[model samples]
Target: MAHVGVVGPSSADQRELDDAESLGQGLAQRGHVVVCGGLGGVMAAVSRGAAQSGGVVVGLLPGTDRSAANPHVTVTIPTGLGELRNALLVRSCDVVVSVGGSWGTLSEVALAVRTGVPVVALRGWPLPGDPAMHAVDSVGEALRTVDALVRTDD
Candidate 1:
């Protein structure tokens, strides 16, 4: 199973949240591990979806308080590294999936792309055409792209 990191804004809109939730559930049902910032908005929705579907969720929190993590998180790591934890999150995953765009999400995508980790962007930021970065429109496309990348990497 792939360790898939799901990145997005903590203050996402309804559409993003819905997509993130569905993405999480799909990733879980497909036997992939879900990783996230473990706060709110997209993170919380994704975590909830994944947890409800019997998937494991690793939450790398920016703060030192485990309680700050969303309740759906299966394992909480309070790194206290602030935004720098984004690097750790990206590095820990086999593939990074962006449900929406934010400064933090952009940072994760940049790190993953720069470090040779595959990235599947779902309605995310426009990149400069990196081969490792895939832009997708729907949750199904994102899952398919992630599966292809992980299989190719293996």
Candidate 2:
């Protein structure tokens, strides 16, 4: 029922990829939309999962060509802003779920926190200054947290 951003490294290990895929599937099966960077790594995995589950996927790409987007993306938006497109991805989400670590993913998390959009992280930035951004254990917990956070009027 919500558009969730899935952010993480463009190159990650197999476990992270699996986790991200599961998260995407879970979100999709629950009728939520998946949004991501639209390239490779976690982005591709999540997109694939969502697509396989018959869920919609929106990829905010960083280049001028939609060809760079993952094949599973239902909708691709090429921003031509490169990394700066990270801001757009965060801003467009109802909530963000970060799968693994990277400067890019951290930036997305920081933007989401600053902009009042809640983040359900898996294995990303370790923000000691922001304990509130710490990750929960599983994909289900992440989605549950996101649902709980977004449902609040605050």
Q: Pick the candidate with the highest lDDT.
A: 1
Per-residue lDDT tens digits for candidate 2, residues 82-120, read 889999998888888999788888889998889877788
Model 1's alpha-carbon lDDT is 0.92
lDDT of 1 at 39: 97
Candidate 2, pairs of clashing residues: none
Per-residue C-alpha lDDT of model 1 across residues 1-154, encoded as one tens digit per residue? 9899999999999999999999889889988999999999999999999998999999999999999999999999999999989999999999999988988889889999999989999999787999988999998898899889888987
User: Per-residue lDDT for 128 in model 1?
Assistant: 95
Off by over 4 Å in 1: none
For candidate 2, the per-residue lDDT at 145 reads 86
**Residue 111 local lDDT, model 1:** 92
Q: Report the error of model 1 at residue 104, Å.
A: 1.3
